[model samples]
Target: MSLDPINLAAFLGMALVTYLTRIAGLALVGRLDLSPRAQAAFDAIPPAVLIAVIAPSALATGWPERVAALVCGLAAMRLPLLGVVAVGVATVVALRMVA
Candidate 1:
């Protein structure tokens, strides 16, 4: 296997752009005087994005994964992000064992 210089440079360029966007977003948001309603919507973005990424795969996979997703969703209501992820992974493994 060979390391292609073009691919490596492309990957690094994309990573820099992504990083800059996030930093710029933070800088821009820091100066905004957002109302409570807008702030609430902004705070919800991370979890919404997390669900958007994970929900499709979870719903389309086997029963164990679906069940785990449900359990994870429930846990998310009360737990932090790390805890929620742990619960999801553990639930899937346990359910798979029983299946």
Candidate 2:
């Protein structure tokens, strides 16, 4: 529960790697020609990766938090993304307060 040099270093390292990979891909993407089917699949990868990264953390936090996030995510899908996140955060805070 403390911010330390080691944690910061690790975070920076991961961020650097992520940034480089994304930048490299963006730079190289136009140089290659992907088939229509492959392009469609590639387009979906970002969301899939996001879900894979978020799902575990959301689930590990417990049912209440997960439910809040789902409702928020749905709302975000329908409304603004920021609004959905706010609603989900509010839900979690309210639940925690009541409990």
Q: lDDT: which candidate is best?
A: 1
User: Candidate 1, TM-score vs. the true structure?
Assistant: 0.86
Candidate 1, residues 22-99, lDDT tens digits: the string is 999999998999999999999899989999999999999899999999999899899998899999999999999999
Give the per-residue lDDT digits (tens) of candidate 2, residues 1-99. 789999999999999999999999999998989999999899778657766877788889877778876876688567654566678778888877776
lDDT score for residue 71 of model 1? 94
Q: In candidate 1, which residue ranges exceed 4 Å CA deviation? A: none
lDDT (0-100) at residue 6 of candidate 1? 100
lDDT of each: 0.94, 0.80
Q: Estimate each model's TM-score.
A: 0.86, 0.54
Model 1 deviation from native, Cα RMSD in Å: 1.5
Candidate 1 residue-wise lDDT at 43: 87
